[model samples]
Target: MLGAGLLAAAGLPATRAAAATPASTSVLISGSLASYSTFESKWNYLYPWGDSHNGSALMVASSSNHNHVSLSGGVLTLTSTPYVGDGFNYHSGTVYAKQQVLVDSSWPSWEVSGDFQAPSAKGTWPAFWLTGVNSWPPESDILEFKGSATNWSNTYKNTSGAWSNTLTPISDPGAWHTYRAVLKKSGSSNVQIQYFIDGVLKGTHTGAGFVGQPMWLIIDYQMEGSSGSPGPTTTTYFRARNLYLARSSS
Candidate 1:
């Protein structure tokens, strides 16, 4: 049940980084937030690595392969099926935006929000997050389900590895919920990042040296690592919809 707050505007062209896709541009996002949902399409399958991201599941890259990635109605599902024998034991899905957001001083105050219905079953990890394109740190974990009833909001400050985490427990883990992040620059160097669940503010954190970093937005289903071991033997699912990124002048 998406609301009026699900921001959507015209889709635009964007460049890709190292992926096999086309290319991307660092456009100053202004006005109402627009949707640049493409490396070429709405989603790009897998990380540039094609599979596995510090997790037990192997990412399935083929868009035609519904066993790992499927789209029905408006929801995109990333599945993790164990014993698939696809070289990595468990097969899953990962997708990234073709668009990149520059986290510099000039970037307009932007917001990224999406509706996700993820598995809370142990060993099934799903994340809606952003990471640096050429480096690490300056990461904003919009919504992370570490195989629990708790939603973890995290922001990595810098390369030296300082981060702040806020855990919000879900009363109904299977129900659809909205998660969002709003970022505003604090001074000449850092940005104040705020976390939200169901339109309510959860916590606010500061990112160090975030002004110069550019990041790629990603959503993937990982198994076992932070979610613990001995995962579900049956197939697991992670679904997302009504995703948008908006910018404002302030």
Candidate 2:
């Protein structure tokens, strides 16, 4: 099933599952298995005041002329362009799935996976992450590239005050690579998270306090925080596609 209760706020009705449930399995929520050809149909642009971290960029909404986001050939392109507006010299894009909030106990297990081509320019920080709906610390950086040759992926469980991360080496940020995370119940009120890149298992961690609480997704191409000052002088772009999400029976 599509988890109508979760998507109702976004105006998307829950749809019937496309296949039969396994004898030992149930799918709680499933995103479109096909490509997302339009931005508004599945996601909403996020506008954070003052741009988080006071970066040298403004996050803009999707529009016809600005060209901050586009979808073609099953690929969604998110661009960061130089623009002088409101004393800021650059503007970029950030978006979140319409079904934003997810709680660990809502389902037994869940998976989030996608193909990404990171932006390579200096001071360009692009990330696909999850954050607590009501607080910070309970966040997961499924994929984060801080304009470096290495990529960082991590999970944070605030109640336990623990974090787990993996640093993977990469030669080309512009090349498409697969990234995924699986979160499943480990013990009472706790969960184990596994991170993967290009089909290889990268890291694992166990944490509590994430269960039974809400977390929302975030994807953005930011500038000059820990990525350093003076972002790309020219326009830079990041691409992602084949984003898939599903919940499994406990």
Which residue pairs overlap in candidate 1's backbone?
Answer: 15-23, 15-24, 16-23, 16-24, 33-246
Report the C-alpha lDDT of model 1 over 119-155, residue by residue, as the tens digit.
9888988999988887887789999988789999999
lDDT of 2: 0.72
TM-score of every candidate:
0.80, 0.80
Per model, state how many residue pairs clash.
5, 0
lDDT of 2 by residue, 1-250 (tens): 4576766655664573344655344432244323443556666665432243357777775545337766676677778888777877677877777655454544758788888999856788888887777677577888888768788887786345876778888778689999888888766677777889888999887656777656777677777676776778898988888877667666
Query: lDDT (0-100) at residue 223 of candidate 2?
Result: 77
Residue pairs with colliding backbones in model 2 are none
Question: Model-by-model lDDT, in order?
Answer: 0.75, 0.72
